[model samples]
Target: MKNNIILSWIEEGVVSIPSFLFSEYKSIGLTDLECMLILQLHAFMEKGNSFPTLEELSNRMTLSLEQCSQTLGSLLTRGYLEILKGHTDQGIYFEKYSLQPLWKKLINHQLLVEKEQTEQQLKLEEGSLFTIFEQEFARPLSPMECETLAMWIDNDHHNPALIKAALQESVMSGKLNFRYIDRILFEWKKNGIQTVDQAKQQGKKFRSHQQKTKVEERKKGGTDTVPFYNWLES
Candidate 1:
């Protein structure tokens, strides 16, 4: 008897509900009862009953037929549901429900949320970059310096982290000026260095080359120490 019941239950099939509907329905301004009605409608549509009567829907839920009708009306008014007309090959016309608007609202809401998150993250990064620059320079940035920083990010599309790395490189070379930092950025760009690690590797190579040149200079009896890398020369 239990095996028969299980088999019958399996034969009844299952309704596929989008996972986001459960989590985000409330955010999209759907009340719990309205969302439940939508789920019931989805189940009926999935089972090939595109237009279940309110009596049939109410039979499955605690709501009365009139309540189901009113809830469906609310869904229609809110643009979350639509009644679409169609015709069969026999030229018979019928009305069916379409959940396309509901799906569109969910998708558009998710995209808007992601866009907001990305914008917030960009603002935080820009703020932190400015703070780091001010701390390193030991003074507030001038209006022109601020404009240059914004230009590097907004116009030149340089990564803030990569710019920070360039500033560090300038500091290490004892040149803590905007022009020196700009030169470092330009040299890194010319060398196709898009990341801080790549810039560091390139710096290592330049230092090695400088060391080899100094050795050759020593052999030629030249004794002026090449202390800092001149990115302007590079």
Candidate 2:
């Protein structure tokens, strides 16, 4: 019966995913093992709102005692469970493992720290206004793009002031990403734009050009219309 219960839990769904699980894991990633471990925790918790002992789980899963112990240790370290040591009715004491209830709270703290560091790094880069972007938007940035942004901010090659202005323009124009930033930098380099004003001017001109093209396209058939503008504009 004990083995049947364990198997039934596994068969029902080796993992009990909360409704918010996907959105939470989307930022990082979740693994099958992690999911299974959490489900096991849910099952054991049902007995008396306490974690199952290593021996009980081992016997139920038909795993060697050593394997069960190791598995529990790994699950605890990986943030899937938290082990609480306590005493039972008998004089012999034992430990219990259960899912942490305040996981979202913990995640918020980590995110806050990462955001602060990224903003400070951006500020130190080329003294560009692009650092303000950190305050306005929070998106998953790739490691490579993050490094590039850091380098750009550390050096003055990208003109911090112009970068900041361009970033604002991009945000207003519904464009954000390293690719867009790189394109702005390339255009600035070509036009020898040194001040924020130059960048803003170019941005205004680009907007005007876009508006004209959109108006022209409306005059023509919106669909099946192709213009010989730059790749980005197209």
Candidate 3:
């Protein structure tokens, strides 16, 4: 019976385990062995909904019986897994392990902290206009572009709100760059774009023609790339 139980356990990688066990495993931080055990245990449980035998877990992890038993005991004590009731050819065995809820709560807290850190970093980045300029253009603003942006923000006292909105729109549409902003201003100054709606409409028009030209030129083995600033200069 012991041999049969061991063989059955060998067939399955998991000893009976509870969900809370892995949650605790994550909280205590899983070592390589623990991680391997968790992965194998999960697989075994998935197949039979029973605990894996000592031989089974060892085989799955390529570990010695002693090593697998010791690790399992540690996990059981750490509140990461629990054994339920079981019977086998060898005799009766404890059930698979289970996790406790406290571990789940802790893991959730850690995830929340990570998410907040990311959001805070983004907010700090968004605080500065220069950072936005650098990211959008992939290169620093040219002397002329810098001068225009500075004048627009500092001297003309242009609506900071509108500038920010336009900047965001440009970046999202992949049309962001000093030349793009300059073009928008040039047109706006010429009665071409006066509001966000007009700016969006202009972007759509540019995209339509840009796509059309690209497809046509590609068919002819030619490129239809144009420098946004060069068009204005011409």
Candidate 4:
């Protein structure tokens, strides 16, 4: 009864993984068994085994039912496996397993790696723009805030000089948040205000108008005077 089942299956087929997965997934903290679990899920997909039960999975490997359940739970918790609901040919809905989360993660990790490589390439020539933000904001930047600043510099084509100018302008105007700084940048770009000198000249004009408005309100003896620093509109 213990005929050559192992030899027969070896003669039947084999599972293959992308060569890059070994290094990349491991670099991202997946252990050997975790990677094998992913590969086994792929094998189940290849066999059209929609929802491989714990017993079926346990039969394929040396793991017990509880071990298989725990491994699957770990994968789910780590966001590598997702369950999908589907309909059978007879119009019955059932749950199936998917490896889409892994693929999505691969794409994101690839982008993050590429970003790091680019930063390293430029490190010798340029200082970190993130440091400038942290200095101006007077606190350590969160990961999200660092990413946003990186996007502004790398993706939005914002040069550090202009960004620093925006920061200074925001501080001078008593508005220091990213939203106000972004609005200042947008207004400058819209009005063709390129240099700090141009921005200063524009500020002077705004102050002149504001003073004139205040003087007129005073002449009328109005209790409410015009805002002294209304350059934000300008």
TM-score of each: 0.75, 0.38, 0.36, 0.49
**Residue 60 accuracy (lDDT) in model 1:** 88
Count of backbone collisions within predicted model 1: 0
lDDT of 4 by residue, 91-116 (tens): 99899998888877877888999999
| Deviating ranges (above 4 Å) for candidate 3 | 1-28, 84-94, 99-110, 129-234
Kindly provide the TM-score of model 3 when superposed on the true structure, using C-alpha atoms.
0.36
What does candidate 2 score on TM?
0.38
Candidate 3 lDDT, tens digit per residue, 18-101? 554555555556676786786687777677645678998887777899989998888777666776677678896656565443
RMSD of each: 3.9, 14.7, 12.9, 14.0
Tens-digit lDDT string for candidate 2 (114-183):
8999878855664434346555457545578667766765664676667676667666756666667667
Q: Which stretches of candidate 2 lie over 4 Å from their true place?
A: 1-131, 139-142, 154-156, 223-234
Rank the models by lDDT, top first: 1, 4, 3, 2
lDDT scores for all predictions?
Answer: 0.91, 0.63, 0.65, 0.76
Q: Best candidate, lDDT-wise? A: 1
Better model by lDDT: candidate 3 vs candidate 4: 4
List candidate 1 stretches off by more than 4 Å.
138-144, 151-159, 168-175, 183-234
In model 2, the Cα lDDT at residue 177 comes to 67
